[model samples]
Target: MAAELSILVVAGGRGSRAGQGLPKQYRKLAGKSVLARTLEAMHAAAPAARLTVVIHPDDQALYAETVSELAASARAALSAPALGGALRQESVRNGLEAIGREGEPEIVLVHDAARPFADPGLVARAIEAARAHGAAVPGAPLNDTVKEVDANGFVVATPDRARLRAVQTPQAFRFSLILAAHRAAAAGGREYTDDAMIAEAAGCAVHVFDGDPQNFKLTTPQDFARAMEQLKAPSLADLPDVRMGQGYDVHAFAAGDKVWLGGVAIPHSHALAGHSDADVLMHAVTDAVLGAIAEGDIGAHFPPSDPQWKGAASEIFLVHACRLVRERGGMIAHIDATVVCEAPKIGPHREAIRASLARIMGIDVGRVAIKATTTEKLGFTGRGEGIAALAIATVRLPEG
Candidate 1:
């Protein structure tokens, strides 16, 4: 049976206690907004899960800009925007109602958008447990001794750490059960901190799964700064420097020609229209090299307006990029590129593309790699439109 799950992302909190001007979910963390990262993990766990983001009416502008980078699958799976109510329980009820409008799913996952670091594995496990037992939650084993104190400041019984697990999202449940539970709570004027609590109050048995220690939610200013520092200088061994840059080019598809991608000719009805053979793979690689060196891109070195470069082979662009890197006392270490298109099988010519790029960059063929994937018949490249390529290059910096 297909797993039809819906996600209700609660992002409407004012975060007054956290002292952030914007909601905690809207706060920036690790070079991107927290909500975006949370949504990313959710979509990765179940790409087809219907998404309903509960947002404050005032934060519509912020939501639009921050969620623009979400995967296409995620964007398509979203429900209409639902404005949150006065309390977390009310907000969740509103979100569930919005999702219910579009044919209620068998299972629903309620997640905190502020908890951007939640693992996709945890999400999957929660969903699996929910499927088996109707309710599931992820929790970390308690590490500290717990004590209960009365209002008069008298210490009570100590809770056992072995039996206690601090719970975390995503809390998954049967759609009908949670919907009724949320509505009943809202009607009775009860507000709970988490979905698990809401479920427990309603007498729903929740199964616990392993939770990751690194998936702490960002709440305060210090948490935000620490998350950024973690991304900038990761403690993991052998991580790349992670230099990033964007490249874009337009090429009209003309009739009666085979398209060459990453130096391999594919049996396409039309070729990319451009001067100098319009090889998108080479252009992308050249731009990546320039980006690595902090220099300008393909346009700066080979302008279309320049007569000398008109109709010139794109291999020269790759060759010139290698020369520039060598001039700066650096070497071409490796190049990995992906060609995006919908026509003329790309798998057959991947090897040839790798060899050609290796020759142009003057590196071993093993140092060059090419991959091809389609947009699954969606965007410009997906509709038998022109092809595009994205590339990432790695190089070792010399000792000063």
Candidate 2:
């Protein structure tokens, strides 16, 4: 029963101390935000865990923008952020209260959004330790000698270094007990720097487990710089796996007033006939993207036999193909598509088609190329009986 877990990521602080224009947790790190990586680590460690985030109320737009970089699964696992208070402790309390409204969790992991290097293994260790004990925190042994200082800035007591532990978050606890502790603290008009103290005040025994030195929190601009240096992606062009794929599609014309092409509806004397809207250009590009990822074709993803996809806007297919590429850690370097038709005059709408494709694919306009061609009385397109499209996609994948 205690195995069911919930994790709360605290990202409410403005991070003004970090000397960044954005919150430290929202700043880019290793091609992703610190909070994104933090959420990813927690999800990887406990796939079954429910996740919640706490944020400053004014940061809704910023939060939305930052979370877009997360993987789809991680984003889906997250609950809407609980509006935070002025202090870190209050913010975490708000998150806890919000998570309570959902359901009671057996185990709860309270994590700092600024620490992105806490990997799944470390999280697992903390979870195990917490389940064994009433509460537990991940901490590393002190490498520096410690001394207690007074208000005069003079050493009052020199403590043994062996007993000192620098605790880090993803502090784990029994949900009920920690919740009770936080509520009690709030009622008493008290606040602590971290959740462990609340547990300690509530007479719950908290244990410490081995922690990674790399799981350091970003506190200032210098700290962020150091983290960037540690986590930045190095030169990887040489190790990349580049791939190219091609697709071709043809659709016969039927009487209609307009036709959909590359997500844009253009006035035409006839519309393409197919199970879907038969945006010939979109079908070709989608197939090309899927092929580049070695993931079959558009037909596999959007089967014509399924009633759900009947008369579907074909842009859905292209979006799916693009998402597949992203899920595989691949990106579209370029997508070049050619339209073949003897009528409808594609020359008048070439740029519009390209822009539409770029929007659907979530790529830049420069990366999407659309051109028009004619069979010149050589085939069906030459006779105005149908339209054909050919697409070539270039993809870049990370090497193993």
Candidate 3:
């Protein structure tokens, strides 16, 4: 049954009401385009269903770019986009016809590209309702009182809000039933707002199932802002995998007047000796971050054997480590580092070192903690012969 299911996403509107430029479906919400998020949600709900998008003729380039943003699995679920018509109803008809040519599906679902938050439960309910009644739509009960007004702006009637529902998609249907209804509507020169209405006009019984309130459509700039905030809000139900890693490093004093510590150059009696700028703090932090992701140490990535990194800045290593975390869909939550040294008084430059580390890691200064400690003449660091630093990193990754 899953293999026989198909979905059509309608995205042909100019979206002038949302803004002056760029269709709302193509606009970005968070870091992803609205249409990409919608497609990903639908794919997650019905992995076996064949997905298709209906788009305007002028939006070919934009459509391509949006599809490129999707994951490989989501992209694999999609068929070629069907060219849309002047009206939304006409566009849906074109999409249905295109799906028919590819091979008619037993069931079909029509959804709006601006609605990106549909969950798996809603889709299961939609499929079950369609199978039972032949046509179905998801609708949420209205919360506000509804009124019917006359042309003169006088209240004509106060309808019972108890029976009213605000409808949402994907509206599910048995394939042959809705195709005939749409064909009949087009032939009779009658246009309906949604497929359920057209099915009703064609004498078919349409069922209404419960809908999710978060499945609201994106229609205005305010709606976009709200969606961004909603995505940013952390939920316990989808908590990330938190991890911590520790790193330690030591560098001996060499024959230079300046030393690099946490990407900051400070005047000192001797420089730290290493392949790189030998910023002990930065190297320890970089190793800690890499360890948090289980991606080996800094030497494994940038080996001392490689002469290309002979005089490289330690910031390069830290930046590369952070980039790797982001590439894996993870984030560095916090970093705490303690420098072990008896010289170059770390107290006077603590804030500067913290600020420098934050800028290099692309995180806030508050997330980076810098502290200084001494072994009280009990270790080599107390003898002022070398500088040692230890770091602990916390990271969060998407739960597998």
Work out the TM-score per prediction. Answer: 0.59, 0.58, 0.60
User: How does residue 133 of candidate 1 score in lDDT?
Assistant: 78
Which residue runs does candidate 1 get wrong by more than 4 Å? 1-3, 233-400
Relative to the true structure, how large is the alpha-carbon lDDT of every model?
0.76, 0.83, 0.88
Better of 2 and 3 by TM-score: 3
Residue-pair clashes, model 2: 0
Q: Which predicted model would earn the best lDDT?
A: 3
Worst 10 residues of 2 by lDDT: 230-239
Per-residue lDDT of candidate 1, residues 1-400 (tens digit): 2238898899998876667477878776756788888888777556668788999888999999777968777777777779998888888899988888877889999988878765444665667678877888888998789889999989878988899998888889999889988887887787898787788888999888767665677777777777776455222133334444444454657875687666556777898888777888888888888888788997887788876566556766665666666555566677888888877777878888887677556578988888888999988888777888888887644444
In candidate 3, what are the lDDT values of residues 1-400, reduced to their tens digit? 2349999999999888787779999998888999999999888667779999999999999999999999898899999999999999999999999899888898999999999987655776677678878999999999899989999999999999988889999999999999999999999999799999999999999999878777889998888888987687443234479888889999999999988898778899899999988999999999999999999999998899987567776776786788677656677889999999998888888898998788667578999999998999877998889999999999888888
Question: Of the candidates numbered 1 and 3, which has the greater lDDT value?
Answer: 3
lDDT at residue 156 of model 1 (Cα atoms): 78
Poorly placed runs, candidate 2 (over 4 Å): 1-3, 233-400
lDDT for predicted candidate 1 compared with the true structure: 0.76
Model 1, position 294, has a per-residue lDDT of: 81
RMSD in angstroms between candidate 3 and the native structure over all alpha carbons: 19.3
Tens-place lDDT per residue, model 2, 72-91, is: 87888888899999888889
